[model samples]
Target: MDRRRLLTTAVLGGAAGLVGATALGSLSPEDVWAAEGANAKINPGDPDPNFVEGRVTAVSDAVVFVTSSDGTYHSIRVTTGTSIWKLNPSTLDEVKVGDGLYARGVRMPDNTLAADSLWVNIVNLNAHVDSIGRGHLNLDHHGQRVVAHVEQGRSAAVYNNTPAVSDMSMLQAGKHVKVIGAWHPDTNEITISTVYAAV
Candidate 1:
């Protein structure tokens, strides 16, 4: 198996057995969402928090393991409940293995980082198009290729309302564009929020 597939399987297996009933305990769904939102925004500059800054060491189908500059390693498991979105879709492909990452989550006893949200920092990208398809666009920025999925709508009204691929004609292969969206590592897809041609 390829390295990506192997990593994904290992993490998912660990999460299934270790997470257990902990996610079902005292926190209500609303409480959990609120906590997750709060956790998602925590950063190192904060006065007091449980947030950690690290670099992605490995990305598996179900987990992303990160190591901090201080030499601490964290095993972050992604689940159906995990929220993965990009601040910029056109630039999402800019993230790489050695790139820096900031994550926030409730800590586990084993010192693994059980992140509620994973944010890909895009400050390093020079911005360019990698490839484009009939219903998809691949962006090459920094050292990664971010793929954005687009689908046609039934009518103009429907097309206007659909965020996935509203303006298909505006996107062209090899054209410089910007995108913003979310990433789903489980399926290896990115749901784009917006697509823009580079000025």
Candidate 2:
């Protein structure tokens, strides 16, 4: 057990930067939508009438009915170019009733939302960095290990609450972090979208 402990410690030590740094933010709106299997128009930081938050109530061939948190109802149309994300990249067929959602698109004359992108059950987590590995990192969330895989050129890091950047080197092991990622199909693994930390 002594040798095993020593080896494990060494491995973790090398993996853990044990330095002082941080990271923050998420994928661009267009990139996020594209990951859902479409390249539809999803303008980033635009002040247009193109957003909705609600719970799915019904789904038809290419249309979805939803009830907003305020009790208002909306008809959202999903086109071929419309992107849908549920946990991981997903298809329209996977969208089900009762799933919370956020959609961005244009409004048709009939008042139905022509969705360009839809993200279902997205999660934002606060955790502490446990260890770092090549192209991945281990995070601790309430005592559970959340293995976050780094997507090449996609993971954004923000240190000390500064502007977001694509440099993962800013992330130091053993620091508290905010992770924006998608939960893997049915596992503790997560595909990291962005990470925010304080140095």
Candidate 3:
């Protein structure tokens, strides 16, 4: 077998006996996302060619089948080393048909992706802050109002390229911000994991 397939087989063997947190490891979703992108030669903001965005159409053993939003079909191979995020670090069992996915991984010679990281129902949105309420922010995203809830202890804010902090006190009304969070499918609501705004 080729090196990639060989490595995948080994991981599948090792992962079959593990589940939950022990199988997924402690890496944050963004850590895996950014780390994989950083190692590639793509420019910042340029879509990583190794990335795939789609909806899960099927799942079998360690493989997930997806149909991209644009209609391309993909086979994603998940191994123990893959970091999965479904709201938080997750297991493959949490993935379901119809769930949206964003995956980054190495492409095998057969055109399958050997997934390094998989994020289910994740959204990165740009919006204008309309108002702030008790533990939440009302946002206007492309003219649609959205309710973003602050997940205390997990929610954080990043300002002007500085380190992220849990304090969201600097957010102001009518300012533009980028939101990275888990989307509540079919609804204009999300739970904020990180908010990027000016200090």
Candidate 4:
């Protein structure tokens, strides 16, 4: 079995086992994200109302400060329940200064977002697999060049509505793919999160 899959499944199963973990007067970080997300009044398909997307300018314990592209400032608070995803499901330690983040949660009266989820360096793009290398993919996204990295155990492929598979051998040259990934800041490069193919 894939190690990444095991890690994710274990975390999710642990979260399940922790049910009423809160009732015991304590909850895990996984529980926090589940609980907070369940409580928020969110509009489906619309960008999260209180979502904040920015680069980390500072990190002080559980609080991370960010500056958006438009120069607006936002403070996002990470909790035990908040889910943090880097190239894969990760922990807060993977988050660092200068990392880009997309946070979804409740905006407190004090202006800090109590984040339920944080997707660090995440991006979604529609591109053509222009070429392939031993461990990389050259992509053309609307005429823009992008280099997509292949992280073993982390990268997967989805073909024709089927489940994603670890083998990327089916990804042929000149094919179009909808890719979700972690975009390297200020660069055309991205570490693929998932690569979905139409045919």
Each model's TM-score?
A: 0.36, 0.51, 0.76, 0.75
lDDT of each: 0.49, 0.69, 0.80, 0.73
lDDT of 2 by residue, 105-155 (tens): 667667777765687766577899999999999999999999988888766
Error of 2 at 29 (Å): 6.8
Off by over 4 Å in 2: 1-60, 64-76, 79-117
The per-candidate count of clashes, in order, stands at 10, 7, 0, 4
- Tell me the alpha-carbon RMSD of every candidate: 11.3, 18.8, 4.4, 8.8
| Two-way lDDT contest, 1 vs 3, winner | 3
Off by over 4 Å in 1: 1-49, 88-96, 122-199
TM-score quality measure for candidate 4: 0.75
TM-score result, candidate 2? 0.51
What digit string (tens of lDDT, one per residue) describes model 4 on residues 1-199?
A: 2322322333334442222212222222223333555645667766555778889998887788999887899988766556677776677788888899877666665778866568788777888999999888999999999999989988888899798888888898899898878888778899876788876
Ranking by TM-score: 3, 4, 2, 1
Candidate 3 total steric clashes: 0
| Pairs in steric clash, model 1 | 7-60, 8-60, 8-61, 85-182, 86-181, 86-182, 88-180, 89-179, 89-180, 90-179
lDDT, candidate 2, residue 134?
95
Question: Candidate 4: worst 10 consecutive residues by lDDT?
Answer: 20-29
